[model samples]
Each structure stands twice: as C-alpha cells, then as structure tokens.
Target: MLEASLKTQMQSYMERISQPIEITANLDSGAKSQELRELLQEIAAMSDRITLVEGSDDAQRKPSFTIARTGTDISVTFAGIPMGHEFTSLVLALLQVGGHPIKLDEAVIEQIRNLDGDYNFETYFSLSCQNCPDVVQALNVMSIINPRIRHVAIDGALYQSEVDERQIMSVPTIYLNGEKFGQGRSSVEEILAQLDSGAGARKAEALNAKEPFDVLIVGGGPAGAAAAVYAARKGIRTGVVAERFGGQVLDTMAIENFISVKETEGPRFAAALEEHVKAYDVDIMNVQRATKLVTGGNLVEVQLESGATLKGKTVILATGARWREINVPGEQEYRNAGVAYCPHCDGPLFKGKRVAVIGGGNSGVEAAIDLAGVVAHVTLIEFGDELRADAVLQRKLRSLPNVDIIVSAQTTEIHGDGKKVNGLSYTDRKSGESRKVELEGVFIQIGLVPNTEWLKDTVSLTRYGEIEVDAKGQTSIPGVFAAGDVTTVPYKQIIIACGDGAKAALGAFDHLIRSSVDMPAEAETATA
Candidate 1:
C-alpha cells in the first residue's frame, strides 16, 4: 500500500506533461507485474495528459513497458518491473518523453553521436547506492537523445541468475555491449571517453614508463594524498596509484565529525582532498589497481593490473578497508533497492522510513544508533546470543526508543518485491522458528577487510592481514611506510588516517635522510 505522504512527494516530482505521453504496458497478472502495473497506473492517473494502454502479455516477451511521445516512434523501454531505485528512472523517462530537454554538454553530445554501431548500456544498480542515480540518469538521457544508444537499468537483486552469469560483484556496474565498462561511480565525461576509446574490455593502460619516483603512494584516500603532498613538498619526484581517487570517503556521506569544517559531504570532501594534493607536483594515476608488490631491491616495484610497473625509492601503502558483505540471498540484487552497506551514504535517503541492521557487532549497533535518529524505526539483528559491542555503545543503542535488538538470530534471506526490499527473514536460534520483519531497507556492518592482499608477500602483516607498522608509520621493511585502515592503526577514522598519512610521509623522508644521506666528513675522509 502506498502512503499519502509518499504519494504527495511523487506528485511534486512529477512535472506537468506538455505533449501526450503514452505508456504501453505489456504485462501479465503475475504478482511482480501487477504491482508494477498498479504503480504505473497510479503515476498516469496523476496527470491527465498521460495515456496508459494495456497490451496482452506474450510468453516470449517479458513484462515490458514503452514510454514514447504520442506521434513519434522514438522511445525507451523497461524490459521488466521498474521498482526500488529504478522507480526514479521510469519517472525521468516519462518526463523526457513529455518534451523535457536532455540537459547535456555539447561536447558530450558530440561524443555520444560519434559512437559507432549500437551501444547498449546495461547498468546494474541498487536503489540505495548514492551515486547510482546519477549514472542511471546519464544513461537514460543518452538513450533518449541518441537513437543508436539504448540503455537499461537492471535491479540486480531481482535477477540473481543474470548477475551470476555476468559476474557483477558490486553495484553501479555499467556494461557496455555486455562488457564491463566501469564499476563504482563514473562521470558522464569519463564514460564517454571509455566508449570512444573502447575501454570496456578492461584494457591495460601504461603507468610510469620513464624515471622512477623517490616516493610512490599506493592508494588515493586521505592517507595516500597526505603522503603524496608531504613527499612532494620535499622536492622529490612523487607518484600515486589509485583504483579510485576517493577511496572509502566516496561511500561516506556526512562529515560532522571531521574537525574544522562544520559540515560537508563525501564527494565534495574528496574533491577538496584532490585539490590539496594537486597543488604540488604529484603524479596521480587514477583508476589503477595494484596487483602485486616487490620489495628488497634498490627500487621497489609495484605491479598494476594493467601489467605496467611503478618503481619507487620508497613506497607508502594506504589502501583503505572495505566493508564485509553478508553474501545472503537478495542482498546483492536489492542493493540500494533496500539492501544498503554504508549508513552515512544511504541513511538520509530513507528518512522517516523503517530499516534493519544485520550483525550484532559494534559496527552494526553503531549503524542502528545512527540511523534511529534519521529513520522512523530501527531493527538490529545479531547471529550471536548477545551484542558484541561495548557497553557504552549498547547503552546508547538502548537509549534510543525506536530501536529494537534481536540477538540469537540468523538472517536467513533478504526479501524484496523485485525492486526494493520489503522485509527480511531471520530464524530465531532458540525456537528454531523463522521470523520476518517488515522494513524498507537493510544495512550491513559486519566488519572490514584491509586492502593489503597484494602487499602480504612483500611486507610483514599481522594475523588479521593488516600491514604491520611502527609508531612513526614505518613498515617492517625499510624504505616502506604504511598508513590508514589497511595498516595497524588504533582506530580507523578520517582525521586519524590523515594524521597517519602525514606521519608515514614524514617517516619515508626520514628514511631517505638516514639511509641515503652522505656519511659524516670524518668517516668520508677516513675511507678516502
């Protein structure tokens, strides 16, 4: 059932249709189809300028819908039920069909027009992904403006088999003609470049074919950027390799705790970080993943996925930690649809809605406490018999009236209505009975895995696989420094990582001074 408040919100977003917008729904009476059909009908009912036509469903054809201007055959299609995060996509399609101009740069439009052959962009996204909407909108607009371009936004949770076949491990993954075009957040300009250059096949790009850097940072997060800036200040040739420039900050939403700045968002903060680092001559290689690391030589070697090697007199590792996934059914597909990972990134999107947090650890409890203030209600589920969080955290979570804690519970499956998560099923350990909770979203905060697998062979790692580092951020290997969540840091926070990065950069400089400096004058004269 749709709430009146939600209906009002939808109505406000529904711009008035000028030209006649025709929606032909070729749907069966199945549950998913009927649900989508009803929602579409409701949307059409809001605008008298819109027309809906119900066509007989054919077994060979999927439950699809086409939105087109009344007179033209140029149109877009939704092959399946558009729900969850994709609901917005459908609305945008309707608006575009109703004569809304495609707002894109002229250069970008030229690039799109230049793309030869049929370019089918199938972007898999979860409703909860903060960056997904932008990517989806870009593809949708491209499809509307260019006849050669056709885009489809697929709900990964709804099609598990397809996700498996395609090897989609993450959300906001774009497939260009069945090949992975890009993963994570991508700009329209970046996407255009990838399309124009045929970079969908994961082509290897060369990095640092010439002189070796005095210092090379392996990540692009706050830690790595800090190191780069510090190293560059010393007037040494510095380089940086990053899978993405933002790192974990991209997934983080609010920044109230970041000292000095009263408030800021993730993307903005990341851009600032980049700006600060770029002030110096830092050779930044964005979107490059490190596959291996070799130490002990005069120059350390960092191998990338592209087969290009980066050499450095000193190497600083700052690859941040990644969230651990539950790997439960519906978890992958419904990502952003109702299954979310970062509370800070996706919590505000679900304001005044009910949600659940899986895992009884400190992270889970913390997420529940954080979301309780923004969401209508919170349900915290744990597989253990009791919460593993500190007593203070437990107290804080208990102090919240809208939060519910469920221990000794095993999260069985994530259930959704083909689009967004409607609820989830959990089995009570004591009773051996299955139970279900109705909610709009599920947040996963089990733990984190350090991004140091490539450095394991080259550096001394702790039992947990984190890069072992000293107080000054020096690693076990000389001329090698490490920082951030990937190292043996006491706490993983933005400020702490920044401080750690600064320390590591200083330590690398110190190593250069101590190990490479000319011997004292007396010793040099004695040797001569």
Candidate 2:
C-alpha cells in the first residue's frame, strides 16, 4: 500500500513537470509554440519581469526560462549548450535580465535618456582577448543607461559569416547602426558623444539644418590629437573624431621612455594630451567616426556614419595601431580584472598583484623587468628557445629579483574565478610537461598592427599595411598626410610617434599657409 501511494505521488509530480512553463522561445521556424507563448504573455502581463526575446537556431523548441524583469530582478537560461567563452555570454545574459546597470555616471545617464531617436551600436571582439572586456562593459553600460541605444555584441569566432559580410578582420570593431565607427576599446564619454552627435544629426535632418565642421579628423591618438590642435591653432575650422580619444596610448603599460617626461602612464599621458587639445577652439568630436570620405574640386566632403557630413580643405589620417592578441582561453574572461596588455595602463592597478608576461621579444622582457618592481611576482613565459630582444635588455631582465623566465613555454589557458583572474596553465615544449602558475594578471607584449586600412584607398601602404610617408610625414597624396605607427617610420616607440605627429602638424601648417597664398581669388575672398 505504501509503494502504491509513492507511485501515485511520483505520477502526479511527473504530470506537473510535463506542463509547459512560462518561458517562450522564438525560433527560426517562424512559428511560436502557442502554449509557451501564451504562458510568457501571462508572465509579461504581471509587473514581475521584462520579456526578452533571445535569438536561437532552433525555433520549434520552447525557451529555457520565463525571464522576469521586476525592477532589478531578472533571470535567463540558454536552450543550447554553453561552453568556453559562451559561458561569459550566459553570465552577461543573466546580468541583462537582472537589469543591473554597470556603474555609470548619472550625467551620462541623463544625456542618453534625453536622446529620442534610435541609436544602434554593434561591436566586434575576439574570444581570446583580455582588453576587449572593458570595451564590451562600457557599451553594455551605455545600453542600460538609455533604451534608445541598442548594444549588439558580435563574436568574431562564431560569427565568421557576419564578419566576412562586414569586412571585420579585427576585434572590437564598433559600428553605429550600419556604419563602421571605430575599433578597439572605447570610453563612456567617447561613446556618449557619438550617440549625441548621431541624435543631433537626425534632428537636423528633420529641420534641414546645415552640417557642422569644415574638416573632420578620424583618429584622436597622439598624432590625430596633435593634428586637431595644430589645425585649430592655424585658425582653420576643424573637428576631431575618434572612437576613443587616447587611442593605443591608453593601453600602454608605461611611458618611461617618452621624451621630456621621466616617467608616465598611458592614461595619464593621454589625459594631459587630451586636455591640451580640448583647450583649443576646435570642435572635439570624441568617440565618433568618419565612415566615408569624398574629395571634390575645392572641398573634401566627409560623411560620418552617424548621418552627419562635413566639408574640409584637406584630410589628415592619424589613426594609430593596436596590440596583437595572444590567443588563449580565459584571457578574454578576466582581461581588465587581471589579464592586461598595456602594463603602463593596468600595471599600477595590479600593484602587489602576481602577474605574468607573455612573449620573449623586447617588449615582453621589458614588461617583465618593469612589472617586477611593482608586482609581487613576475613570471615571463616565452614560446621561443631564446629571447629575441637586445642582449642588454635580456641580461637586465635575467638579473631582476622577482622575474622568472621560462623558455619554450606556451600559454594554454587562463584560470580564474568569474570575477577576477587567479592563475594560468601552460605547456613546456622542450620538456613536454604541463605547468600551472598562480598569477593575478597576464600582459601580452607580442606586437602591434597599424591602423591603416581606412587609408588603403588614399595612400600607398607597405606589405605590412603601414602607410609610406616621406621624411616630413607627408603621404604620396599631396593634401593628405600620415603619421605615427600608421606610417613606415622604422620605430614603433611612443617618442617616435610624438615626433612624427609634431612633424606632420608642422607639415600641415606649411601646406595650409601655402594654399592660402595660392588659392583662387574667390576662395581667398571667401576666407577674407
């Protein structure tokens, strides 16, 4: 009798389980399961949660959960298996459902809330990147701050189809709506400005107002910023646009070798430089992109992807370079938290934290030596048998007290908690042994790739894609100029880029003065 009663209870429980839950999945089949859809509708009618329709391949299957969006409370689950970096996506999905907005300034929030039109943001990133997380977080915060702003994350690994369609070969490529904005990490202020400008452009279109600025500079790196400052100083109406104002400098670990200053950081150096530029009369289009450029007889016309257009006498290309990624698991998961590329930018953030430097090149050895002074422990992992840097630097690195060099060791995985990095796993090629090291951060010092793709249609690029410029930083084209790492300037150091930028600015001034003297009477009359 007891067995029969137990069987009856089990049967009742099974029946209850068989009944559909409140969650509904909108699959590709163009058919929504009526029962599950009705359940979700019932849940949405309540003030408990917001209804989120997540995209999935299977349309016939019911959604895994009925997400509840009551104030800050929300939950989500994937119908398909979540593995590798997809796990990170799962966590983000939950965060989105929970309505937990990442910390953002109230002023920024207010600015975004005032936006009336649609603002679409699409960002591309690789799964093996460490710095990409900060950028993704910044975009996510922007989306939460304003409903008009929609943030879409494209996985460079899984979305090869979309990548090819969009011509995205690099990580962290941002597109505002359907137009390409910029690439790499961006700040909150920069992104907000871009959205605001887009909103303004749409409003102007509705009212048939004239566009702003005469010339638009696409990058805000040292070279780009210097160009803007110089252009403004020359009394030429100019505007500077960049996805982020600092460019690669913000990702640098240190600036000890930069001229004049004994020591500095990526962010500090960028901040001071940015402030100087901001002091000028120029219109600072921070966190924006010049998507298309059309050269006419007298004026160079530029179309910003934000639906804005500007006319200029000439265009200056100063987009900088980006660091190459060390493809490995867990690197992307704990990037700014523990895994970092620019030691100068994030090294101090890891003060007394255990850190590892990857690669055996000059930058890697140099980073290891520098980090040894600030971090508790420094582990240098090299995939090569011998260090490829200068002998003096190698000797100096070897003599460091807290630095350990492990040759023929390749990083396999980054191990960490969901919130922060903890350690790393590597394999020794020479000994055929797997090893693990406890570390707080990993700095990738492989190399850099120049920002020269946009100039491909305008100037001559080397096989490596760096622009070919003369001694005066003048490109093959007469009015257009190239500077910094984007050019074949032999050296890729900060001082070199600064010197190049200064020379380019002077070159631009010379060109502008010459043009002012040799212009058509009508053009001169207009200026007068």
Candidate 3:
C-alpha cells in the first residue's frame, strides 16, 4: 500500500518509538481485510518494538485494527485503510501510542487527561477529504490521553451500510456516544470547547489578561501570517488572533499557483505558514474569532466572540473570505447531508452517483470536470448566459461526456428527504420556467464572500462587503489597515495576499512613526 520512499520515511519515523506497541487486527474473509493485513504486516516490519496480532471475530467492524500500548487501555481504532490525508493521522497514532511525546501545548494535554466521564467517539471520514485528518488525529490524541475516552476513525466508503443508516452524506462526520456530534473540520480546541462547557470562559479570561500588542492581526491566512512575520521582525510586539489560523486556505486542495513553490496542498502550505511565523516573535492565538473593532485613541480594541477584548496600537485586518453559499430552501438543511461546497473534499463520497455543480465560473466548471471522472453524471448550472471559466477549462469541461451544461439557470431550492439530498429545483431565466433535476449531491462553486461583515459599519466596505484599502493597504480608518481577500485588492490569490499583507504592516509602522512625532507632548503622554 506504501511506496518504497514512503516506507523508508515510515521506518525512520518508527525509530522514535520508545515502548512496545501491539496492533490487533479484527478481520474476516474479505478483500479489505486482506489489504489491511498486508498493510499491518508492512508496518510491523518497520519497527521491532511493534507487533501485529489477529483479533477475535466478535468485533463490530471487520477489516479494522487497534493500536495500543502493550499493557494500557489507551488505544485508537481504524475501521479502514488510513491512507491519503489520514496517513499522517496513522503515523501520529503509532508514534503517540508507542511512547513518543505529543507536540500539543502542555495545558491542552493536561486538560484532556483530566477530563471526567466515559466517552465514545466515532468519526466517519473519506480518504480524499483534506479536512478529515485533523478531526481524526485530534480524537485519536484525546483517546490516548484519557482512558475514559475511546475513539474509532471509520472510513465512510468502506462502511456504506452504516453511512446509509446514519444518513451521512459528508466526510468527517463525528458521532459521540452514538449520537451525532458534529460535521466538517474540527480542531482539538473546538472539540474540547464542546465537551467542556467551562473551557471557553477559562480561555476568554486568559486572553483578557494579555498585554496590548503593537500590531494585532485578525486573521491567519497567508495575508495574516505575512503581516505577523513582517511586524514581528520590526522588534515590536505582534499578535495574530484567528478563528482557525489557516482560514479558507485549509479548505483549499491544490495550490500550484503559489510562487516559488511548484506545487503544494492547502493544509501543508498552511502548516508551513504557521511554522514560518512561529520562527519569529509573533504570539499566535488560534481558534479565536474577532466580532468587532473599536478605534479612536492610541490603542484599537478588538472584541472577540468569547467576550474577550484585545487592544493593539495598530490592527491589520486579513480575515480573508469564505465560499459563497446559494442561500435557498433546503440548502442549509442538507448541508453536508448532500449540499457541499468543496468538490475536492466531498466529491469521492458521491462516487457513481449523479451530482450537480452550481455556478459556471472557473470553480464550478472545474468541479464539474473533476466530478465527471468519479460520479455517474454532472449537471453544471450557470446563472449567467455563458460560462466565465477560462477557455481551456471550458473546453475540457465540454469534452467530458458525462457532464451537461445549463446557461441562465438560477438555483431555487435544494430538495432532500429530511436526511439526504435527492434533487434540486431551478429557474430558467429566458423561459421563466421552473425545473428540477434528480441528483444525490449539489456542489456550490460560486466565488467567495469577504469575511468583513463585522467591519461593515467600522470601515469603508464595498457593496459586496470587502474592505476598501488604498495603495499602501490602508483602510478609510487612519490607523487601521486591511489586506488579502478582505480588502479591495484584485485577483484574490495567495501570492498577492502575502505582498499586500507585508505592505499593510509597513504602512502601520509608518503611521506609528508619524503619529508619535506629531502628537502633542501631553496628549502623547496621556495616550501612552
């Protein structure tokens, strides 16, 4: 299952195992079981400290395996092959179970170990999903930390019966104690917040006690990371507070357009951005969303959703953007239950099933083209008279036999059977006729909406909600700056965002220098 180069890397990684570990395989006479057996054998051969044993047939899922420390109940189970995005999760589980120290913050680790009550978690994931590994790896770490917590990462494709029973139409759907917990990507902090009610309050209290920063960035995408690095290098206190640190970039799949880097994945690129910022003196606060911004005095105040307020001399807004949803009936109800935004992440879940792609831009055309290879058929609906995608992409999409294109069609309502999507309704602009199409999934690929709604009244924003900025990346507000997709910059790309972010940081520094020299002595003293 693993290549020669991958095997060499896995072998080297296994050398960090300082304790004996056992892999108990629960298998039956099945093709997947045999594949799992071979993969387990290959893994076991990489390290002498590891051993593989056959488990009894009493297990609930065949072709599953558990990794556990020799004499400890601390273990995590995998019901399907943990390759693709989950390969990192498998490696982390192996090393963590075999006595390799976890790299999480000490406070987080302690909190997990101290949690009370017994809990069981089952995470349903697809191999192609870019967001599943984080959820799986987080639950795996928690299970290993606290014996009272047990988790199993199940592959949705391998357990189609269970998926149908649960009405799971999305990847990385998590269930706790046999009840639905959440859907989509999740972080360790987010999971803990849901489990422990007091975690948020405690976190807010700690954040409230932090000192004011010279430069505070309100996002963690490429733009935010670049701003943080530039500000931190100026020997000033810099802080980055973000809802997810990686923002929309984490949801992106391929990033071949990023300059200097030939090709990379979103998660990997986000990790590199974090690592680069960490090399500086930037204080990163992850999983924190800013709700409001106040500016008048020397320090600008940013309010968080957690009831915490952060103060800074200068604020850089790089909150980025999110996928624009076609808000219609049943769309929200069937979200992740059949209506998804990411084709690369959730397309595999609809294999051999008919699906539809909304919008006719590059993203939509690309999605339709990609889904044609995996799904039975694809219908591309465009509100415009013609597709806005590049000529090459439109040509490729037209060549796909399983794909159909509809122009001047507006999505009206998504139809679902309470649990999963079955079809959708649309309107023909030219004929003014209503139409319906039967499909198992709907992929929304209509552009993006800037994450600047909170700043609508605070700063000058375009009708579309993007922050308006000058050449120096300065907003209408004197001391406030904005960059990336949140700003008025054209061509919302990663490289452009980085350059804009750097410019914003430099503009803030220039403002600070001029303000200090121009202010009255007494006023400056009072503000300071």
Candidate 4:
C-alpha cells in the first residue's frame, strides 16, 4: 500500500479520471487477503476511474487476491502484498496500464515495439535492495507499450523456494523468458540493447567494425564523460569504450557532495553525464569493456572484451572503482536483504532501525555518520584498537548519542531471518571473545577496489593497483593517460574525478599537438 502523499502524486499524474481497464480482485479467506482487499478498496475509491471486481470464493486462482486488467490478463499480481520498494513498482504499473507514457527514450521504445517474440521477465529482489527499483521499472515500462512483455518482481524474502530453484544469490536477478538475463544494477539502455538484439547471458554486443579516433576513452563514467566532452571541444575524433557508461556512480544513492548542484541521485546524474557527452560529436561505444591496451607503437589499440579493437593516437583511462566486499558467510546471500555497501544508497530503508558499520576507517566512519541521521542507532565495529578516521570526523561521530564505537572487533557473520538480515556476530580481536548485535542492516565501507586489473603490464600501476598518474593524468606510457578513482588521486570524490578527467583530456590534446599531427597553429604555440 502507498502513503497518502504518493497516492496524491499518482492521482495528479494520471491523464484522465477514467477506468481504462477493469480490475478483478480474487480474494481468499486468508488474513493477508483481507488486508489487501482493504488496500485495493481504498485505491478503487480514489476516483471513479478505478473499477474493481472481486472474484468469487471458488475462483480458480490459488492466490488470495489477484488483480489484473479484465480481458488482457496483464496484471501486477502481488500474491504476498507488494510492500516496501515493490509498492512503488505496483503504483507505477497501475499508471502505465492507464496509458501514462513511460517517458523512455524514443529509440528504446521503438526497439521494444519491434520485438518479434513475447518476453516474460521475472525479477527477484529484496525489499532493501536500492538497485532493484530501476531494473523492475525498466521491464515494467517495456510491458506497458509491448503487451507481449510481462514482468513480475518477486520479493526474495517471501519466495525462498523460487530463490533456491533459480540459484539467486544477489538482488535484482532478472530472468527473461524463463532464462537468466542480467544481474546487478543495469541501465535501461543496456537492458534495451540486450532485448532488441536477443543477447543471452553474455556481455553487450561488439562493434560492427573497427574504428579509429584521435583520442579513445576506455571507461565511460563521469570522468570519461568529462574527458570526452573536453576532447570533442578540441574538434578531435573522440570515442568512448565502456561496458556501461556511468561506472560506479550508478551505485551511489544521493550525491550531496557534488559541487554547485544542491543534490542529485546516482541514476539521474549518470544519465545527465551521458546526455552531456552525447551532445558533442563523440562516438559512444556503449556496453563494451576494454580488456587490453596496446601502447607499444605510435597507434594505441584498445582490445575490448567484446572482441572489437579500437585504434587511437592517444588513450584516456577512466575505468572507475568498485566497493570491496565483506566476504563473510551470508554476506553475499543476503546482500540486498540488509547488507548494503553505499550508505547513501540504501540507508533510508533501515529508518529507525539499528545497523552496524564494518570498518572503522574514514569511509566506515562516514557511512556510520550518514546512517545515524536516518536510522535509529549505529554500531561501528573496527578490527584495530583505534579508529583510523580523521580526528575531526572521530569527534563528530562521538558527538552523536545514538552511535556506539567498538574497537578491536572483527565481523564474523551476517545473521538474517531466512530472507532479510536481522543481526550480526563478531569477535573481540583483543579478548578473543565473540558477541552478537541484533540489527536490521549492516553497511560495509572497507575501501574501494579500482577497476584497473585489465591494464596490467600495459602501463605503470601503483603497488596498490591504482594507475600511476602525474598531475596532468599521464600514465607511464606516453599518450596513455589515466584519471578518476583508478588513478593515484588523493581522494575519490566525483568532483575531483571530473576535474582529473578534464585534465587528462587536455593532456591528450597537448600530446596530439606536440606530436605535430594535424595540429592547429594556436594549439602548438600554446603548448610551446
């Protein structure tokens, strides 16, 4: 059931107050059904537009209540009530059935329309999974225009049987036409590309032909986008090669630290980055990852994981970083259930609930502080006897009465109530004593693992595996530059990465000019 404010928003969003489709509610004698009936009744009473029909007691459907468009049989069937994030999915589905535009890209919609075969998508997600909403929304949006496409988002907590049968160990695991499609947080563009091309569980499609560029960016995060934009302004033939544009930024929840803009979410900012890059004449090779970099000769060849090679005079590396994992038992099994990494992304789900922070470093302390404002209490556990965070941060964290710090603590396991995490266990590193803390969530903020393993031996890398970049973002190899979290940057903030990307692009442009390859007179003079 939706809150009053959200219902009002949905009502206003509807184009007209008319019953575009009839709803058949099949109720059972169960208590769950009774509650659902009341909720449905409230929705039906919203306007004369919602016409509801209750099925007979002897209804063939086994579920207590099943709601679907009368004749089409297209439904948002919530056997177990669609609570939490699924509730929003249900509301949006109802709007789409009433002919509300999904507001997707035109080209994507057209591709969906041209789909030759019927597609059934089953998405399994935990209620606490922040990334689940977008994946669920994408398939649901497709089902709106293409009646042949059907989707059902199942809460992993309620359907443990299905979870085991499918071997689902992660949230947002999508099954298309009864076959595994994709997992993790995927973009609408990536999903659309897969759908149109009928790709299986493999990576994105390869380039049709090998192409050359004046400068090639290997990753397409904010840094890559900035680099591309800057290089394109120089009228150079710039191309971006990435598995998916937006990189790790897509995993963040809300970005308050980004300068200038008051606030923005990960997906919105990622989309804006892509849109901004597209505005220039940059060749966007989407859904591709560069596996190998060849910087031996004058021409730099980038071999993609998709088996396509891209040649460029200079290359910019912007492959971003990923969060390190806890690797504890049940940690992977209940990742989205209550074990979350980005506090900004999934913190709100634990509102007024106790949660634990695994690391006592700056990142872990920061996550605890962020969660303290939204959650009821925070327990910060560190293996070291002393916290590794800045003294100022430590003071700020201690000021919060609801926050508790545990020194010399090592997390042993994440305990869940079958579906969702409800507690955690740890060991006292100093005393060798074990303890348990009952909580609804656990946030892991160990450190970031840069996405630079593929660049091994191609260019210089730090002992920490981050690319060794100078002030200008140049790597050890001439004409091969690196930026963002993958570089030896002091901090991994988005704004800092963007500035580094711009600098790397400029450095590449300067290399192009110094080499005297079709360089503009003004550019060569400026470099001199």
Cα RMSD for predicted model 1:
10.0
Tell me how many residue pairs clash in candidate 4: 2
Q: How do the residues 5-122 of candidate 4 rate in per-residue lDDT, one tens digit apiece?
A: 9778766754453336555676677766677777777777765667777877775332434335546655554445566656676677677676556776686688777788888888
lDDT of 2 at 253: 46
Q: Write the per-residue lDDT of candidate 1 for residues 1-528, one digit (tens) a residue.
A: 357987887776565567788888877767767876887788888787788998665633346677877987557776566655566677778888777766665856766777787888888775556566657877877777777888777665555567657755457778888887887677665676566665422334445454788788999999998888887877777898898887888776567788898987676688799899999888887767899988877888888876678898889999999987888899888875678787754665566779999988877898998889888999999989999999999999999999999999999899988867888999999999999999988999888889887876678998888999999998888888999999888778899999999899888877876776433343222210
Candidate with more favorable, higher TM-score: 2 or 3: 3
* Model 1 residue 149 lDDT score: 83
Candidate 3 per-residue lDDT, tens place, 1-528, comes to 789999999999999999899999999999999999999999999999999999997999998999999998989999999998999999999999999998889999999988889999999998889999989999999999898999999998899889889988887899999999999899998999999999999999999999988789999999999998887777677899999988888998889998789999999999999999999888899889899999888789999999999998889999999999999999999999899998877887898899999989888999999889999999999999999999999999999999999999999999988889999999999999999999999999999999987886789998989899999989999889999999889999999999999999888777876776243333223211
Give lDDT per model, in order: 0.79, 0.64, 0.91, 0.78
Q: lDDT score, residue 460, model 2?
A: 80
Looking at candidate 1, what is the lDDT of residue 78? 69
Worst 10-residue lDDT window for candidate 1 reads: 519-528
lDDT of 1 at 145: 71
Residue 113, model 4, lDDT: 79
**Lowest summed lDDT over 10 consecutive residues: which window, candidate 3?**
519-528
RMSD values, in order shown: 10.0, 16.2, 3.2, 5.8
- Better model by lDDT, 3 or 4? 3
